[model samples]
Target: MGHCIICGTSVDGVVCRSHQEDVAFRFTGNHPNQLTPGRFYEGTVDGFADFGVFVDIGDSVTGLLHRSELDRRLESLDWDEGDTVYVQVTGVQDNGNVDLSWSIRQSPREFRGEVIDSPEGDRLPDDEPTPTTETEPEPEPEPRTADESRNDEEPEASTNGGSASVEPQSTAGPIDSGPPERVTVDALEESVGERIRIEGRVVDVRQTGGPTIFEVRDETGAAECAAFKEAGVRAYPEVEAGDLIRLTGEVERRHGGIQVETESLKPLAEADAEAVVERLDDALEAEAHPGEVEPLAEDPALADLTDEIADAAGAIRRAVIESRPIVLRHTATADGYVAGAAIERAVLPLVREQHDREDAQYHYFDRQPLEGEDYDMAAATSDVTRMLDNRARHDEKLPLVVLVDTGSTAESRDGIELLDVYDVERLVVDADPGFETSDVADGVVPDDGSITTTVLAANVACGVGDVRGEIAHLPAVSYWEEAPERYAELAREAGYGADAVRELREAVALEAYYQAYEDKRELVADLLFAGDDEVRSLASHVSEQFRAKLDDELETVRPHVETREEGDVAVAVLDTDAFTHRFDFPPTALLLDALFRDLRAEHDRLVVVGLDEADLQIRSTEGIDVRELAERVAERVPEGGVLASGVRRGRLSFLIGEREAVREAASEIAADLAA
Candidate 1:
């Protein structure tokens, strides 16, 4: 019976067996899976080569059994190109080359092949010679015993295949060691059933009714990590958003989406956080868009804002200078720093100097109504009027500066302040780089009369320099010439003893050296005028004048100048070297703290503020002192604050320098005061 090579079926069983056999010689097909090389297969020889012959299988491509890998010995084999022969798929080279051989052995019937016999079986010869035994003995007949009967049962052997059973693998536990398999930002996509650990900083955090959603961002991008309220509230009492945290969790693709969900989180320390942030920044390339910022000033919204600022400033000045009981419906500072000060300045003097300078009724009304506190406008008015009455009675008028700076903050949307100026009779003044179109549009309503806002372009100081100078020299200039000994004695008692007092004399030399090397300037002039008291005196006067302006403006216009001076004129020495040491920043803070502690012991009621060289204390002052003021100013200013500042901004530098000087004086006098 012939079989179909392609389908592996017997052709004899089919109806068309006779016709199929004729075509079967010309037909071809392939073995299912040819793993071993040098194996021959029977098929029509499709093509020929010097190395091998290609035999066509029923499949599209022919299989080539390489001559080198073949087990056949080809000495002389008469095979036509079209003849059906066997070939094997030999070694498959990476370059898509194939090899073949001719002589090969047929497979056994028991292996996979079927026996092919001749169709015509001739009933010819059945004669065959049988070999005779050489020396055969006599044949004997034996009788079987009754006990050896064939029906007796014999012992049976076990036939069931006894295979060893495999123990099942454990599935219930956490991984012991080694870094968790790292999944990239892209690879995190397909991982649905796996556990993962993500390292990043907590960018944003919000507590919902159910869980706290936190955004953790590394260099690649940000991912969301959620902790249940019960867990998060307990875990994050000491830390907040912007802290560095690591999360380990079973990942669930949210809504079958791509983002990973972390189930647990742990906080990272400052050093670890800093290193991570550094790496992230290196990857992110965070950059400031200076061009973007500059164009913002020319924006239409900014133009409108400038007009409103002018109006607010004009109203404030008129109300303050004219001694009118001003009721500002709305007044806003750009960032609330200066504007807040402006508002306080407007209300303060009415209470302080009102008793003496009563020209008109003095009434001030202020309450942070946002919090629903009832404003005591009436009581404030009575108090102001009484102060004004007293000032008038004493024939004294306090000099006040109406500080007019630019308009609202970059993000402010409130325009009610502009509308209030129109409601009241006041004028507006324009500062440099005046208001934008948006400010004008927002400043007033369309159908109403516009506020009488003036546009003034003048550069005027608030005399704070003069005031600060006067206040600063109050201890020295006031009594220095009259009683130097008494003044020195008082300074020593206040914690600045002889050493600190002596250091003040050497301050000029120190400042000179600082200017020479640090400022990169020739100190020839300073050296020539070294002992010239006249020159030193002039520089001291200039410094005092600048300081006084700040002091006086803050003192007279705003509240009384709150100063925490560590050095006292009564007794002291200055450790100029300690003041100028370029150690890490915190040491500066500590030095200032020690200075303030000593100063606080003496001036129980004074507004103790450090200025100039002793201003380093401002870096770490806890509350609303020079340090706090420095911090606040730094935060409000776009030019980075004291902590985050560069050398050029020098706001912090100025504070630090001033703080260190005060600290030096206090340190020099600490022992003397103790004695």
Candidate 2:
């Protein structure tokens, strides 16, 4: 009989049956049959297959954690071979094969207690000291150096140069060896093939097919250190990201970058870790903020948002310094693309300059285009999944999510909250003034009709890096109508004339519709920042296509358009479903924009209504609130079940069965523009 570790109740083993679920067991038996069903067991990842992962519970017994049992997709599992994980033994087959299920409790600290389950009986783990009544008088301990402390905690090297065995701490250091002097990661260039020690925080860890790479960051900079255990195996299962570690290795130039071939790596003691963290904090504080960069063309609206823009820039710079990924999510529109491209131009240069890796730019910065103006749940969920997968698989820090021309309205609150749940740093830059400014974002720059989102992002980008010339024309390109003279002049100063800017805007709009989801970073960069000849050639060709497509769509819709007037407002209504191509180029939003521009030339106060079977789009010169319009329509025609879906795009949803009534009500509301 034994006492339960938690309640001290008498039981057959160390843990009672009622408390078994709360404790994790270390299997000591050699066969699969020894594993008790429904009991959690600590296991090491043996290998992975297409169907599932092979986990070894003990020396001889292996279990299959099938993909179906995983909480996430099989490809999303971040566990490398030899990583210690927890699993529940679901059953043992007739042939002694074991089936395991995923356990929510991953870390041992999450469990109430740990026990050793063997063929003899269950017992406590070896590390759990036995309680004793006798006490011994302790002698005064001598002060130990940081190197000696690390040596005591270092894992014993295996004879085959595979997995390591952790041994109890010893008071004495290695025989006939003195402590190695610590060096910064930046100073490793001069010490190729030389063995040296470095102390830094482990910023990231990635498990490759051949070796485990640890991204170590000291006060000077960050660099990768490769530690080999076995192919497709974790080198040091105990060391993880965010740990302060002391590592001794040989500096070697690998694949055109500096890498450390690790000989010994271990966590630093608390005091040493704190000292290193303090040093890193001070250094990051000193270097993370970029030099002051003024806005290209200042407006009072932008001036009011100066603090927010500075904060956004600071957040981006700090993310780069900390080696965290930067994810820019923007609306899939001309303005949004311009905004995203401006920031991308600024960030890519910084990423290249900051990291030594050849592929660091692609790895650190990402731009994803959202289909709608709002960062809805779908987009946020996708972002969360990708970020979590990166963190789990690569041990990467959660990225800074920058939402440009999206994630500002009340409709995006749910998505913003999801990011908030993960404590992700969010920076929003939108021209929409209806955004929540309280606690939804770490930094936000909301404009009031004076500037476009591209202008805001360009200003923020200037603070991120020195890319003023590269993105000077983006602000002018974002404006659908005539851009402000100041921004147009700024573009001219940057070598882009008014015709060049207009052509680039049209080219981006056309391209943005084709691959509505893709970022098209290279193509956008060429169109915006390529040499004058290339830009003019590409932009002119693409803009020709844009004009042709728009003209074709307009010709088809013009004949079907019906004109109505209530009081002084001219209302042009088009049954978009019947008149326009549903799946072709010039999407409804873009089509409506062209129609509005054409009809606006005829009437002073006009509203263009693109009416579909289930939804309607409105474009007005009167600055009508789409949400309020939807409300009035819903009250007038209750059977339509009308709802305001997208405010920025002036979109409303209604029941298909009541399409005619909804159309009439929407047309009536559109006439209210004259009011």
State which candidate has the highest TM-score: 2
Residues 1-675 of candidate 1: C-alpha lDDT, one tens digit per residue: 543332333445211221221111211223333322323334566775666556664444465644443333222345577775654444445554444443323322211222121223111112412212232353462342332122123221110011111111121232222124445344556666565666666655544222345656665555655544231132234434556665644455443344444433556555666766786665544311111111111223234444343343343433333333443222121111122222333344433442221222223323111100111233223334554674455322222212222222211112323323333232222221223323422222111112111111110001111111111211221121132453354444544445433333233223322322122112322311234565545445534543343333333322222343344322222232233233322222223333444544664422222233423222111222223344444544324224412111111333443444434333233222322
lDDT of 2: 0.81
Q: What TM-score do all the candidates reach, one by one? A: 0.21, 0.73
Predictions in order: lDDT: 0.33, 0.81
Candidate 2 per-residue lDDT, tens place, 125-177, comes to 78897533333455464465565576557664321112222232332222222
- Name the weakest run of 10 consecutive residues (lDDT summed) in model 2: 159-168
Which regions in candidate 1 have their CA more than 4 angstroms from the true location?
1-178, 181-193, 229-238, 256-259, 269-271, 282-675
Stretches of candidate 2 off by over 4 Å are 1-182, 187-197, 208-211, 228-233, 248-263
